[model samples]
Target: MGAEGWRWQDSWIFVSLVIAGGAGRHRRSAATRRPEGIRLTDVLATADHLNRSIPERDDVLGAVRRLAGAGLVTVTDGWFRVTTAGEQLWRSRPSSGMGTTVDTVQKLLNRRCQPGDTDWTLDEDEYGIAVQEYIVRLLPRPRRSPETAQERAEPS
Candidate 1:
């Protein structure tokens, strides 16, 4: 995909690597100045910890593939490391507003019901429904066309 086509999952995976210290300059041994990268397991664990929920392994792999395809990350011998381009992308992300979706989702998922509220227990289906409701509410509504808005304003 193009540079502007980064998905939230992609940003989250990249950020997780950065947060885990798998990106940027690393302290190197005097003899061998090689950079260190984290393992795939570490990435998954870091992402899970950051989001407070387990991310699907397949989804993480998919994001890695996309990042790799974009030359943002490199995978070698089971180690994943961010490329220079990736570091640049991360550094400039604040101006591009890339992490908002991940932040919003993290906040929503981390929200807990108050102690005095009704029992927070939920079955699998109930949890699914609740999540769907939240997603629907959070998504932006499409704007109506000017003609449609005028027609509605005119009333029956």
Candidate 2:
């Protein structure tokens, strides 16, 4: 393979590593952020807690792992201090990672709803209206069905 091939392979590898890494980074960031009084294990804790309260960056775990790999944390000790750049990034970036439950649930629904259809751009109010309309018209909903008005009008 050429240089391009190597680069493409490396890109894929990076993405794979990121996927494998999970929410580690965000956890580290959170650990670093807590006050001096807070305990690492107490505040920035187990998988269940991570999954429950702090719905941070999609690649958060990877970030934490990277921090560990870079000597930011002693994994065995379960303690980490935020690096300067990480602090900068954490401060500057939007908190889309720690998303709302509603946003997350709606995202799942959006994926299941369509691929080729219109993209999900509706506001919450609009979605509520759309869903209501959809439910009301769920079975045998109106469409520009073939056949004259007489056929539909007559019924079965």
lDDT of 1 by residue, 73-111 (tens): 776765667777666655444332333636542233223
Global lDDT scores for all candidate models: 0.55, 0.32
Q: Please give the lDDT score at residue 105 for candidate 1.
A: 29
Q: Per-residue alpha-carbon lDDT of model 2 for 25-144, expressed as tens digits?
A: 545534344433212223223222324432122223333343334332222333334434323423343345533322432343233222121111224453345335434543585666
The backbone clash count of each candidate, in order, is 0, 12
Give the true-structure RMSD of model 1: 19.3
Give the winner by lDDT: 1
Poorly placed runs, candidate 2 (over 4 Å)? 1-40, 43-50, 53-63, 70-78, 95-97, 100-156
Query: Lowest-lDDT window of 10 residues in candidate 2?
Result: 1-10
